[model samples]
Target: MVSIVQTGVANRASVIAAFERCGVEATRAATAGDIEAAPFLVLPGVGSFGAGMEALRAAGLVDALRVRIEAGGPTLAICLGMQLLCASSEESPGVEGLGVIDAMVEALSQPARPRFGWNRVVPEFGCEVITEGFAYYANSFGVCERPAGWACAMSALEAPFVGAMRRGAVVACQFHPELSGPWGLKLLQRWMAMGVAAC
Candidate 1:
């Protein structure tokens, strides 16, 4: 399966290596058609809401992604990538998203701002995740009121924000799994395994 590193912080190399380590053939997205052709597409980022959205729009990938998702292609969105899957973001008011999942990307409201470092990535309903440790996080925004059947990897920030959510073939996260090491790699493998089973 091929993956697209949508943004600069896409962690494209690490993801490719991780999938390769798992015996999966992964390729970087080179064009809009590349994204559409990809059986599995990845949207990763580590920037602000406005900047991230601008990048997608400038790249002309937003609508392409929507079309692919509508067609039922598997997609994995990490960090800001996951945020872009939502309809919109209050973090960057008026900035549009792919709207694949019924959710919104909002910022953390904390007196002590600039939250960082590894945080827990456990399932919202007590289900086990790739591991029981913190995943890498650089952003302060997360998805809210996620749709049912979507697994949430929540973190303890100003509130228990939605760190990750998975629905259908689309798996999204607010953390950087590539930087999270083996456990994160395993999660990608799990997604690939899910796609294989889906086929």
Candidate 2:
């Protein structure tokens, strides 16, 4: 399964190795194919919300992903990529997201700006449906969702930002699942086993 996405700031080798441990043949984001044929897609990011969306638009991946996932396909978004799944992001003043999930990506409510480094995504507030642990985080914005099964994993530092969420065919994670080692792979495999229709 190829990890289809935009830009390459995310370590592909690490992602490949992670997916391989889960019994998958991972590839880059640009393998060139449709939803049914490709099956799985991973969106990873490591930069500003506005800049990342611009890069995706420039590469014409925004619509491509929307179309794919809209048709009942499987997709995983990590870090900044998860931020782009919302309707809008505070990090980017006027930038638009895929709007797959009805939420907005807002910056953390901290004294300073640009929250970085690792945080503990403890399973509090019924956010345990997803992988729960001290996952590595490196993002500014997070999702505020309004769904029944809207699950979120959070760190100890901030206000428990949306660590991971799934709605229908879309899945997004605020943490670096690829960097979380085997635990990340296991969660990813669960998403893969869910298949396209399960979403």
Candidate 3:
């Protein structure tokens, strides 16, 4: 089953609904025990890095998530959840991340405080599963470094920033797929398929 980690401050309900719409069974995991029992995991978030990370820690899910990933579990992280996977975020400096991806989250160079609309993203390499299209983003912070190859996807604001990233069984996106309409739903479907394949 796919477990959506309810950090208590994230948009867990919508994410769970999105997976269900894609014909995937998803459950909201309120505790570490629930998280540990899930085969596939989804970490959905909103707000600042420190708040998000602290919520996970308070829920006793930080270590559990690391353990799960170490075991090669399929995981998907959205929006702030994606940022939390990095080493640290400028939005919350000195706050260590889950360190799943050796990258840093930084404020968007764009003049806009929060990008709240549809934006086009292109696959840097030959990323087949994550198709290039217009996806909705609603954030002020983005991945500081650009994606090197197929392992990441790029989107434009003032310049290119990491929009989507993947490493092994883990895939993350800065945009809200649950609220991105059709394109987002398609992306989630592809991600769900990948999660199933990983399982």
Candidate 4:
């Protein structure tokens, strides 16, 4: 079963449906135990950074997630979930993130409006799952620089930003693969296959 962290700020239905389309069983993680013990895990979100962090903390999942990700458990973090993996986000000043990745989330510089639509993701050399493809995006903030020790993919609204970052069994995407059509489904399949191979 693929366990999805219930952050309360996520588009949970769509994410679960996406996994179902991949022929996988997806369920909400009810406790930290559910998170740590999930065979495959997904952290998905669709709201402000502070609210996401707040919900995680309120649910007592902050430490569980840290431990799980630190142990290199297979995890897929999407959209706001990706930003939550970083140290902080400009969208919610003074709110601490999971700090899994050494980076900060910043607002898109050029397009004042939230980047909402399909954008092509250009994967860096050595990216295992992500390829050059159009992925759906619906965010106002993202990581600008590639964090050290991560294989990153870039997408541009006007200036380039980190579209995805992968290290070990953890893959974080600024774009929502669940909403990206065929390319997204293929990406999900590839990621799931990678996790299964690791096991």
After superposition on all C-alphas, the RMSD of every candidate to the true structure, in Å, is 2.6, 3.1, 2.1, 1.2
lDDT tens digits, residues 22-105, model 4?
999998897999998998999999889999999999999999999998888899999999999999988989999999899999
How does candidate 4 fare on TM-score?
Answer: 0.96
Clashing pairs in 2: 120-155, 121-154, 168-199
Pick out the ten consecutive residues of candidate 4 with the lowest summed lDDT. 107-116
Best by TM-score: 4
lDDT (10s digit) by residue, model 1, range 43-76:
8776677888788788878778888776667878
Candidate with more favorable, higher lDDT: 2 or 4: 4
lDDT for model 1: 0.73
Kindly state the number of residue pairs that clash in model 2: 3
lDDT of 2 at 185: 69
TM-score of model number 2: 0.81
All candidates' lDDT scores? 0.73, 0.68, 0.80, 0.90
Better of 1 and 3 by TM-score: 3
Clash pairs, model 3 backbone? none
Each prediction's total of clashing residue pairs, residues at least 3 apart in sequence or on different chains, is 1, 3, 0, 0
Clashing residue pairs, candidate 1? 119-134
